[model samples]
Target chain A: MQEIEELAARLRAFAEARDWEQFHTPKNLAMALAGETGELLAEFQWLTPEESATIMESPAGPRVRAELADVFSYLIRLADVLGVDLPQAAHAKIDENERRYDADAYRGSARKAPPLSGA
Target chain B: MQEIEELAARLRAFAEARDWEQFHTPKNLAMALAGETGELLAEFQWLTPEESATIMESPAGPRVRAELADVFSYLIRLADVLGVDLPQAAHAKIDENERRYDADAYRGSARKAPPLSGA
Candidate 1:
């Protein structure tokens, strides 16, 4: 959590020093997050599953790391701007997901659990 | 960060318990991450900048939080599977970006700095 907070702080300073926060509206940040996510996907687009699994050890490793970092950075910045606690939000969602996708009922299936009544 | 490690551990357990690790290949996780990110983008797709800036205070806040969690989850899972330290990688990239984009030189600009020679 410190690492994320530190990254967020650094990002804030970077934007502030350049007066770039004006452009960091949630909409812009979200779009930038999507663009970076696309780049992350592109890193593995042509790789087989096995290759993708081993990509961090391959020649393309650095680029993949950079792309991953870009996605992470934008997500952190967006959350910071929106006043959302990134890790806490994630923890809550994981908790919800665990309950929703009961192992006994969803074993080995990619399908999502049906929404709970009124959920 | 413990938050990330814990999230990754939970995801690993979630998949293992359901016998779904076989489907968590890097390629699949990366695509899933991108899909989730697109969903995040959709949360703000129609909002004006001002609307987006205040969206977390609006009725759509919960959905945006959920979408952020989804993106974070898949990113954590993918990094876990590929053995990348997400926070560390992000920190390193931020440091690099700081050097690459001198605030003094690129102030208020959206354009990326040109690559250093042979970098």
Candidate 2:
């Protein structure tokens, strides 16, 4: 979490130094994040599952890393601006997912567990 | 970084416990990451820039956090499976951005710097 905080600080300073904060509104950051996510997905477009697994070893590796970095930067900066703690939110979500999907019953299945009766 | 790495380990174990690793191919993860990114963007879809900035104090805040968590989870998992170190990649991109955009020259501008002559 410290690394994430530091990264957020750096992003803040970078934007402030350039007076870019006015342009980094949450809506803009969210849209930017989406754009980067699209770029990241484009890196894997048309690649077979097997090819995707080994993409890091291919000529596209550096580009993939750069795209991922772009996604992460916008995501982190958005979270920082919104006062969200990224790690804590993620951990809470994982806990919720564990409760939602019973491991023993859901083994080998990607399907969502059915809604509990009368819930 | 430890928090991210720990989250990745938890995600790996979660999938392993459910025998869902077979379903977690890189292509699938990338698509899932995109889906979550869309959900995150949806949280800000109808809000103006000012509304988006103050969203954290609104009722939509928790949902925004949850959507962000979803995006983070899939992204971390994707990077983990691809053997990319997320923080390092992000830091490198920030460094590149700093060099590419000179603060003094680009002050208050969001436009990207033009390509260097003749590379």
Candidate 3:
């Protein structure tokens, strides 16, 4: 996670150097993250399912990557503002998903998984 | 990145165990990533700017985290299918941005910076 931390530190420094912290509020970061995510999705909006698979190999790859990186940067910034350790939180949530998305019943189903037996 | 790699491995194994690999293509993962990102954004859709900042402390935090994890999982899956090294790609993008988004010229601006002066 050194790379993740380093990139985030660099972003923080960039914002701090510019005195942009006031605008670096979680609200703004989340909105920015959403906007970037929307941009990322837009790159695929007109693609066929097969074409979507090769987007990274297509002419749109650079733009797509730029949008993706933007999404990640905002996500990291949002997590930092909220005091969440992103990788740690991600690990915990994925662990829970392992239980919730058990393969025994969910395999081959494209539908949303129902909740487990108990709350 | 060990953690990211571990989660990807586990996800792969889960899919393999269920013979879901046929459905785990890059196209599907990209769409799923976009869908989860939209879900993450929806948590803050109606919040005022002030309210957006405290979402983690609000009742919606868990849902937000769950949606974030989903975004991450699908992103990882998509990159894996596309043969992209996500961390490296992100690092490279940030470095380029360090040059493109120079704080000296961009500070205090809420607007998009115009393209750099040269080709």
TM-score ranking, best first? 2, 1, 3
B1-119 per-residue lDDT for model 1 (tens digits): 37789888987888888878888899988888888888889889999999999998999999999888888888888889988898898878878777777778877766554211002
Which ten-residue region of model 3 chain A has the weakest summed lDDT? Answer: A110-119
Off by over 4 Å in 1: A111-119, B111-119
Measured with C-alpha atoms, the lDDT of residue A73 in candidate 3 is 71
For model 3, the stretches where C-alpha displacement exceeds 4 angstroms are A112-119, B112-119
DockQ of 1: 0.57
Predicted candidate 3 versus true structure: per-residue lDDT over A34-108, tens digit per residue: 667667778878888788777888999887766666766777777777777766666676577667777777766
lDDT digits (tens) for residues B4-119 of candidate 3: 57766866776676666777666556566766767777787788878877888889988777666666666666667666676676667667766877777787765655221101
Clashes of 3: 1
For candidate 1, list the clashing residue pairs, or say none: none
List the DockQ of the predictions in order: 0.57, 0.55, 0.40
DockQ of 2: 0.55
Q: Candidate 1 vs candidate 2: which has greater TM-score?
A: 2
lDDT, candidate 3, at A49: 77
